[model samples]
Target chain A: MTTTTTEQTPVRGGSFEERRRRVEAAAYRIRHSALNMGEVQGQGYVGQALGAADMFAAVYADQLTYRPEDPHWEGRDRFLLSTGHYAIGHYAALAEAGIIPEAELETYGSDDSRLPMSGMSTYTPGMEISGGSLGHGLTIAVGMALGLRHRNSASRVINFLSDGELDEGSTWEAAMGAHHHQLGNLTALVDINALQADGRTDSVLRTEPVADKWAACGWHVQRVEGNDVGALLSAFDAVAAEAGLEGRPAVILCDTRIGRGVPLLETREKAHFMRIEEHEWQICREQLTNGYEGEGK
Target chain B: MTAAPTTPRLKTSAMIASFADPGQKTTPAPFGHALVKAARENENIVGLTADLGKYTDMHVFAQAFPERFFQMGMAEQLLFGAAAGMAETGLVPFASTYSVFAARRAYDFLCLDIAEPNLNVNIVGGLPGLTTGYGPSHQATEDMAIFRGMPNLTIVDPCDSVDIEQAVPQLAASDGPTYLRLLRGNVPTVLDEYDYSFELGKAKVLRGGADVVFVSSGLMTMRALDAAKELARHSVDVAVVHTPTIKPFDAATVLGEVDTDRLVITLENHTEVGGLFETVASAVVRAGLGKRIVPIALPDAFLDAGALPTLHERYGLSTARIVARTLAELG
Candidate 1:
C-alpha cells in the first residue's frame, strides 16, 4: 500500500515540454506574489525570494508529494526550509499551491499574520521547521528521513538550504549523517546565489568547490542552472531513479542569480537584503512578467 | 618510548565516579534502562545520540532497539535538529548528549527546533552541573539558567534512579518538549525509601521539619536529605522538598511547604543564579512572602576540574558542606 501511494505521487500532468511550461508558469506566479509581499513590508529578503522562487516552484509544483488541503498529513512528503528569510518565496509557493489563500500574500509580514517574514512551522502551513537561523533545515530533513524509514513509510524529505549555509559545521555534520544512515529518501536543494548578508558569499567565506564538497561528504551530487526548469526537472528525475538503491542521499547544487527574473534588481550592487525604491516596485513587476513571457519566444 | 607514569597514576576512579554516597545503594544506567522500558510499550519512542551513547547511557536503549537508535555523529545541533524532525514525523525521540553540548553548544537548535515548535523530544542532558570532573567545559553549571527562559520547554532534574525510572514514562507521555538533567551510571537511589513517585509539574515534600526547610532538586535532594539526618544529631529538625520539575514549577506546592517560622534553604546541582534558587526566590518575592532563602548552589564562577568529591566539597555541594552550611545558617 505504501509503495503504491508513493508511486502515485508527482501529479505533474502532461509531457516534458508541457511540464516545463507549467513549472515556469508557477515560478512566475511565485515571483509576483513575493514582490507583492515585499511591497507590503516596504523591504525584505526579496532578493532571495526572487532568486529562489524557481527552486521553490520545482519542489512545490512538481517534485514534492503533499496534500495541499491537508498540510499536516502524516504520510505527506516534508519540505523543510532552513533559510527562513526565504519565506517571501515560500509563502508565494504555498499560496500558488492553494495550501494558503493567494490574497493573504498582502499580510505576509504584518502583525497577527501566520506568514511571518521568517518561516515558522508553528505559524505557517506546510512549513516543516522554523528556518531563520541558517543551516538547520538539512539536519531536520535527515531526521525526518530517518524517522520515515523507521516507520517503513515512503515519504521523502526535501530540505532547501543556501550556499552561505555551507559555512556552518552542523550542515556538514548532517551531510555526513545522511549518507552514513544511507537515507536515499532525503534530498537537499542548495541555492548558490553567491551573495549573503555581509557581501558576496565568496567574499564573506569562500565556499567554492561547493559541488566537490558535497560529493566528498558522500552524497549523490548534481549541479544545475537553478532558473532553468528543464535542468531542475532532469536533476530531480535523476535523483528519483536512485531511490531503490542503497542509501545515497542526493544534493542538487543550483546556481541562481540574486534578484533573478527582474533585470533592474538583478544589476543592483547590493542585492543581499534589498530595499527597493517605492516607485520601482511596479517596474520590478513589469520586468518579471516581460522576462518570463520573453523566455517562451 | 613515552616517559614513565608521573604521580603514581591516581588510585581509583572514585574521584570521578558516580554521585554515590559511602555504601549507598545505586542502580546502574537508570536513564537508559527506564527509557528501554518506556520504548517497549511505545513503538514511537526512538533513541538518538551524538556519538555519546555509552557515555550518556543511551547505549542501553540503543542495544534494546538497534533499528530505533540513531547515531548523529559529533554534532549536537544535528542531534537536536533531527530529533525535532523525527518528532514532527509523529515519533518521540529521546536525544542524548552532554549537558555542555545540549546547553552551551547546541543552544540554538534546542531552542528553535525543539522548544520553539514544542516537539515531544526528550533531551537527556548528561553531566549536569558538577557531576563531571572535567571542569567548566564539561560541567553544565548553569543549564537551568540557560534554558529557563525558553518557552514551552519543561525541565526535569531527577534526584536518583527511582525518580528517573518514574520520570521517563511521564516525559514521554507529556505532549511538549522536555529536558532531563540525566543521572546515569550506577545512580544513587534515595527517593525509593520515601515511597515517592514522579509527576511532570509537581513537587513532593519528602520529610517534614520545624526549624529549617531544604528546597532542592536533582541529586542535591539526596545530599539535602543526608544533611537533614546528620543535622538531627545536633537537634536541627529539617524538611526536604523535592521540586524536580524546574519549569511549570510547582509554585503552589513549594509555597505551601514554606512558612514564617522555618528558615528556607534552596539546594540544587546548578549555579546560584537561574536555577531552583532563583525560581524559589522569584516565587517568594512575587508572592510578597518576605521570606529569606539561603541558596546552597555552585558559585557563579568557572569551577576547577578535579575529583567529583573534591569539586562537590569545594562548591558546597557535598553533604558535609550542606550540613555545615545548614548548621551555620541555624546559628
Candidate 2:
C-alpha cells in the first residue's frame, strides 16, 4: 500500500497538429521496435503488434499517467492487454515510453527475456495481467477499476481486447459488470482488426454491430480509425474527459488494419500469426520509415 | 400418479428442502458475525458474491457495510477476477459463491488471476459435499480434488460453526489465496461442545480410544462422535480426530492417533477418491505403518437429489452406517 501519485501532464494542452506530429513520431518508433522484435522471432504475431502500434503510442505517449522508472506506482493507470499474443506491440510502447530500454527490443522472444511470446504481468513491467487466454483481461480490468474506485484513487483502468475476444461470453459478462458498477474510471480499448486465427472475424463470429452491443451494455461508446493518431488521441481525450463524471464505463472500438505502416505486410494473406521472410524484414522497415517521412513528422 | 388436482396446484417442483433435523437447535451466525467483527477492525475487508448473498450469509456483511459489499451479479468469473483486482490494490476481498461454481465454472480465473499471483483473496464456497439436496449440479463433491493441484491455494473444510468463526479472522490475516468450504445460513454448532478451536493446518484429536480411530472433517466429525456413542454400548472404544484444514494437512497429528493395532477409518462428506482418504492414505504409506485403512465416503458418482437424511443414509454417511461399518471391521 504505497499511496504514491505520479503527476500527469494534461494531454489536451498542446495544439491539435503538434500533438498529432508527436503521436505519429511515437507510433513510428513503436512500429520500428515491433519490427525489430519480430525479426528476432522471424515468425510471431507481428501483424497484430504493428496494427495496434498507434493505439499503444497514443496511450503510453500522451494519455496514460505513469512513471517510466516505477511501473508499480500506485497512481499509475493500468493498461491490460487481453490478447496476450499482442505483447510485441505493448513491448514496443513500453520501450518508446522508456519504461524498458530500447536495447531490450532485440531480446523480445528470446530465452530468459522479460518480453515473452505473450503478455505476462509477472514477466514484463507495465503489463497488468497474464493474457494468452482470450476474454480474461477485461474481467481483470473491471476488478482493478472497481478496486481503484473503492480506494477513492484517481487511477484508471484501460483494457485492450481484440475483436475475437468479443466472441467470449466472459467478455460480455465483464462488460455488463463494468456498467452495473458504474465504473467511470474504466475504459475498454477493443482492436477490431476483423482478422483472427481462423479467418475473418466476421466469418468466424459476427461482431458487426459491435458499437451497439457496447452501448447496450451501458458503456459510452466511441468508434475510430485505430491507426489514425489524430482520431485515436481524440477518442482517448473524450474518454478521459468523461472520467469520474458519467456513471457509465467507456469503450473505444478501434477499427485497425493488421499491418498499417508497411504496405507489403498489410495485404499479406493469413497475417494473423505472421512469418516475414528474411529479405522482407529490411523492405518492411524501409517502407515503414518512408511512410513516417511522408507523414512529415 | 393419481389424476392432477384441477384447481391449479402451486408448482413447488423447483423448491428443494434441506435435510430435516429433529433436534433443530438454533443455528449460530458464526461466519457472518465473525466477518463483521473482523471488518470493523480492518477497513480493507470487502464482501463480494455472485448473486448468492442471502444463501451464503453475505447479506449480513452487505447490510453491515453496504459501501464495501459488491454484488457481482450472476457472473462467477467476474466475481473472482474482481476479487483479485481488489486484492491487487491492497484490499482483502472475500468472494463467496456455491462451491460448484467456484470450483467448476470459474476455476481458470481462480488459477491464473488469483492463485498465480498468490493474491490475498479469500474465496468462501458454500454447499460443499452434498450440503444441499439440489442434486449433483449444486453439490461440490469434487471441489477438494479440483483445488488440491492448484499451487499457492490453502484449502480448509471447517467442521462446525465455531471453527468457521475462528477461521475467518485467521484467513483474513494471512496473505495468500484461501478456499474455505462455507457452511452458511443456520450453520450447525457442534465443535463448541467439545471446546474445539481451529488452527490453520493442525488436526485436533477430540477423543481417544483403543479399538478404532476415526479421522474426519466437515459434518462427518459430528457423525463420527455420534457413532462413537453408539459403538460404546457394544464395548467398542473409538477415537475421533478432526481435521479442519485439508491442504497443509496435519499428517503428524493424524498418524499419532493411529495405533497400528486399531482400525483406522477416514470419513468425509466428499467423494472417496480425493479428500481425507487420499491425504491420510499417503501419510500412512509414507510412514510405512502398514495399517489397514477404510475410507467411509460418498461413492465416486453424481449423487441423486433427495432429502439430506435419506441421502446420508443411502450414501453410507449416516451415524448408523458409520457404527455398522466400524463394528463389521472390528469383528
Candidate 3:
C-alpha cells in the first residue's frame, strides 16, 4: 500500500501570512472608510461599525472561503448581517472584498446609492438577507443552514447579530429553531458592544447572562474578546472543531466597546451617530492610522 | 336533489358528463390530491400548521412528507415566523392554519418578515369566511379585508377545489410571495363550468350579460353564479366576473364590463370595508366608470356562526339573498 506523505498537508506560512496582513490592512481601510462615510452622510450608526472592525477583519482574512471576483459563487461561505443599522460596517467589509467598488462607500445613506442606511437584499449584492427589524436574521440563518445541510455542502453560514437585537422575542424563537434542527454548520457572532440607541443594553432590556441564555437554547457557546485578533482566531478554530464533531450550532459572544479606538467618540453617551467637529477629523484619522500601523503585519 | 333525465342547465351537443351515472363526484377531491403530489415533487417543500393539518386537509402533504412537516403546536405567531425563515433558505413552505388565526393572531409576523421583505412562502388558510360551524373564533369573515392592506403580498382566495388544485402549482411556480385562502376537504365543485385554467392575477369571466354585472371573488363567486341563474328567471340579465386575485385587482377588466348606465354589484365573503366589494368599487370609480356600484358583503362585526349554509344566508351572502339584494338595488 502506498503511504500518503505529510507533504499533502497545506502549509500555513507564506501566502496565508500575506493574506492575513492584507486582511488586517483591509479591515483598517474598511474602518477608515466607514468613519469617513458616516461623516459624509451627516450621521450614522458608526459606533457599532467601529467596534466590529477586528471581528470583521479575521473572518474576511483567514476564516471565510470565497472568490471576490464571483460574489454569488455557490461554494462561497455566506455572511448575514442581521442588524440592519450596521450596514455601515457590512458595506465596509463588502467593499474590502471588492464585491462593491471602494468609491461607492462614500455614497452610503445617499438617495441614489445602492448602500442604504438599512440593508435591502434586493438592491445590493452579497447582502444575503434583508434585515432592519430586530430579531429577524437568525431565522433566515437557520433556513440557510438547513439549505446547506440539505445540499450536503460544507460551506458555513455566519450570521452577525447585535446585542441590542437579542431583546427581540423572535431572536429567541430563531435560536430555538436553529439548535432544534441540529445545524452544526451554522455560527452566530453576537456583537456584544452593550449599547443600543437609547442607552447601554443593560440599562435598556438587560439581556443579562446572554451566554447562559444561548447555552440554555442548546447552542455551543464561546465567549471572546471581539477586538483581539488572537481571540477571534481561537474562537473560530473552536467553532470549526465543533462543526467537525457534527453535533450542535455555535455562538461567539464577542465582547467589544462602543467607539472602540476613537477617544472622543468613545466617551459620548450616544455613540450611535457621532458628529465630529470640523477640526476633530484630523484626530479621528490619526487614531485610525496609528491603530492600523500597530496591528499591521 | 336528483338530476333530471333531460338537462335544464344546458343541453350539450357533446356527451353530457353525467352527475349520477355512477361516474360523477360532486365534491372536488383534487385539492387534497395536488398537495400530496407537490410535497413529493420537492423535498425542500415543508409543511407547517398551528394545530390544524387534518382539518385543513394539509394532513395530505404531512402524510406524504412527514420528515419535512413541522407541527408548530398551536403557536401561530411562531408558525409564520418560522415558515418565513424556512422560505429565506430557498425552501418552498406551505403554512396552513385557520384563516382567523393567520389574519388576526399572526398579522405582525406575516406583515413584517414575510410580506415586507417579500419571502416566497405560501400561506394556505382553511375555512375562509363562514365555511365552518364553529362560532366567532373559527369564522374568518374579515380575513380578506385584513390582509388586503398589507403590501407586497399576493392574496388568492380560491372559490373551490379546482382553483385550490391549480393554485398550489401556480403559487409554487411563481416567484413572489403569496397567501392562498383554502377551501379544503369536500370542497364544493363551484367553478367546474371552466376547466380550471386559472391565472394568478387575471380574472376569469364566467358568464356574459350586458344588463347587470356581478363582480365577485372567493366563495362569494359561487353565490354570484347562483344569483345569476335566479335573476335570469325574471329576465333580469347579469354578468359575473370571478376574480380570485384580490390585491392586484383586475381593475381594467372590471371597469370595461360595467357600462355607463348598467348597475354593478360587488360581492365577497368578507367585511365590506377593505374587502373585495370595496376593492372593486374603488377600481370602478378610479377607472372613470360612472356605473352605480353596490357592495354585498358581511358587515364589520364579529360574525355569529352556525353551519356554513345557514351562516351564509343569515348574513345575506346566500344565492337567494344576493338576487334579492341585486334586484332591490337595481330596481
lDDT of 3 by residue, A13-94 (tens): 2454465565566667778888888878767878788889877777665666665666666676778888988899888988
How well is each residue in B128-158 modelled by candidate 2, as lDDT tens digits?
Answer: 9978777888989999989989999999998
Model 1: DockQ score? 0.82
For residue B15, model 3's alpha carbon misses the true position, in angstroms, by 42
Q: In model 1, which regions exceed 4 Å deviation?
A: A1-13, B1-16
Summarize candidate 1's per-residue lDDT along B172-256 as a digit string, tens digits.
9999999999988999988889968899899999999998999999999999999999999999999999999999999999999
**Per-candidate alpha-carbon RMSD to the true structure:** 3.1, 3.4, 7.6
- Lowest lDDT sum, 10 consecutive residues, model 2 chain A, at A1-10
Best by TM-score: 1
State the lDDT of candidate 1 residue by residue for A1-297, as single tens digits. Answer: 133243435456578888888888999999999898898899998899888988999998887777777888777778889999899999999988878999988998899999998899989988888998988899889899998988989888999999989999989989999989899999999999998889988799999899999999999999999999999999988898874375799999999988999999889886677989999999999999999888763
RMSD of 1: 3.1
* Error at A255, model 1, angstroms: 0.6
Off by over 4 Å in 2: A1-13, B1-21, B24-26
- Candidate 3: DockQ? 0.24
From the highest TM-score down, the ranking of the candidates is 1, 2, 3
What would the DockQ be for model 2? 0.72
Model 3 lDDT per residue over B1-331, tens place: 5776573432221111111112333464455578677766766677888788877777877777777777766667667876776676678878888888899887877887688768888888876776665667877888888898998889998777777877888887777678888876566676877545678998878898867888888878877887899999978888888889997787777777765466788888787878887787778677776667788888888876444555666788888899899888877
**lDDT for each candidate structure:** 0.89, 0.87, 0.77
